[model samples]
Target: MTPPLLTLEGVELGVGGRRFCENLHWSVSPGECWGVLGPNGAGKSTLLHALAGLRPVEAGTIRLQGTPIETLSRRAVARSVGILFQDQEYPFPATVLETVRAGRYPHRPFWSGESAEDQRLALTALWETGLEGFDARRVESLSGGERRRMEAATLLVQSPRVWLLDEPTNHLDLGHQIALLELLLRKSRGQQGAMILVVHDINLAARFCDRFLFLFGSGESCQGTGEEMLQEALLTRLFRHPMRAAHFGEARCWMPL
Candidate 1:
């Protein structure tokens, strides 16, 4: 069997002399979409950061496509991976087009202007993200959903092989939430690349991801197919709720626990 595109082996992440989670082993294969489910303060964000090579690993190793993560330069890593956090702050004043254009930075030489190809890719990304109509709008004036899409557009322009997203549906309405989830599923499962998302909605994860990683507070993790793992009893235990799963046309929907 072919090995996974990304792997975390006995990983340990710490901050300010304290460890949040330790000894994590996870892998992501091509054409796979993995959803990370955990309660608040469960170090979900920390885990994402560690996987993206943004945080210092106290022990163990991270490899991207069999290459040690540390061996890649920051720019090279950025070119290969795109990450969207739950809360991203933009202090600079720039048009939405300009902001998305920033995504092309990793692909261009420093101090160089965007080429014709970069411009074409940027515009295509905007169209893919549903921001074509608002390309020239100020970033500070976009609605919550629009801003989220704008950030997604930026990442799309990166042409990354690996995607990391945190709480991607938080600001989206029901319709857009479904749309985004569908897009993610299509891309990850078809031809784009591997994707790992930190999602709090169990139902959404069940419907979209090929695999699920349940992160527990006890420093252990469980991963398997949605069908094999998203049982009512297991979910009840995982979330400390009376939740139940409902089957809906090749997907499992969540109801109150």
Candidate 2:
């Protein structure tokens, strides 16, 4: 049998002595999109960090393609896994094109300059993220939505096999949110890659993700696919409030009741 793209075994996570998840076992394979859902303080971002090897797990292990993540060098891991954090800051002045081109660093030899193909790939990524004409603009001058899209473009240029995104839709307008999700879906589907994203919007999660992971706070969690995971009771309990699950056409949505 083929190994999963990513796996967590007997995972435990916490911050400042507050536990988020315990004894967690999860796996993600190619062509799958997963949404990590939880209320505030549920450790969603912490979990993403753990998956990306940016944070240490309190216990247990994370494996990428069957090899323990800790055993792999950082550069080796970067070649296959990419992460997008919730907030990003660029301290130096740079054009959007220069920022996106940085994704090619991992693929190049040490101290090598960007190649024509790298530039082409970066431009393609920018076009895909709806930032084609903004490449020459200063990154600091872009609005929140534009900055988010530029980040997306950088990740696209990286082209990792497993994508870990924390609140990818942050700062995006409704249209841009949908457009970015669609772009990610196309990329994942085309390359048979996997995506695990932390998301707060239930409707958007339902629309894009094939599976859902819900953190109920304090070392409790549940995961499932389809309408089974979208149950009213499950959602209500997960959010600690009344929630109504409804459908419009083919989409499933949740609302506070």
Candidate 3:
């Protein structure tokens, strides 16, 4: 079996006096895409933050490539793990290309400006995200969906081995949503790549993710393949509602009753 790229052992966290996750043991391996599923305030985003080392866990260890994440320098972590935040904000005025180019910060020295290779990578990422002609567009002038796609482009330029994405599809239309997820799925399956995304779309997760992790927001959680976690009873209990299952050919779907 292939080794894991990232591992979480005995991880626990809580927010606003509510305990959400406890004793979380999970691992992400190369070429694997894992879906983080939960209701609101279930610590899905919180867990991703912990994995990225941006937020501290209440307890437990997070390892990247078998090394304790805490021991790695911020630059080291940034070089290996790239996070796509749910909310995208551009505090300073810049063009779309300039913004995407910033994602290469970890690869170059602090005094170094954008390199030619970096520019090429940024352009390639923009084209892949369907933002080919957006190079000169002002960041603030773009719509929310366009900005989200731009963020995806930035992550591509970052070129990290592991991706931690929070609501990667927010503000996207149906076609754009599918396109972005397909792109992300491709990235996660690329060379030595892994991904874990916090998403509210159950069908999208089921379609794209081979592995599933469910957080109950009561310090209880579960993880497994889709076949083990996609049952009506599990999802019904998970969402605190009655869920009816359907099949579109061999694809399983769920609807709240």
lDDT of every predicted structure (CA atoms): 0.81, 0.89, 0.90
**Order by TM-score, highest first:** 3, 2, 1
lDDT of 3 by residue, 126-210 (tens): 9999999999999999999999999999999998999988999999999999899899778767767998988988998888888
After best superposition, candidate 3 residue 93: deviation in angstroms? 1.4
Per-residue lDDT of candidate 1, residues 48-108 (tens digit) = 8877789868898999888889888889888878888889877988898888888999999
Show the lowest summed lDDT stretch of 10 residues, model 1: 183-192
Give the C-alpha miss distance for residue 74 in model 3, angstroms. 0.9
List the candidate 2 regions with Cα displacement exceeding 4 Å. none
Structural similarity to truth (TM-score) of each candidate:
0.92, 0.97, 0.97
As a TM-score, model 3 comes out at 0.97
Candidate 3's C-alpha runs over 4 A off are: none
Ranking by lDDT: 3, 2, 1
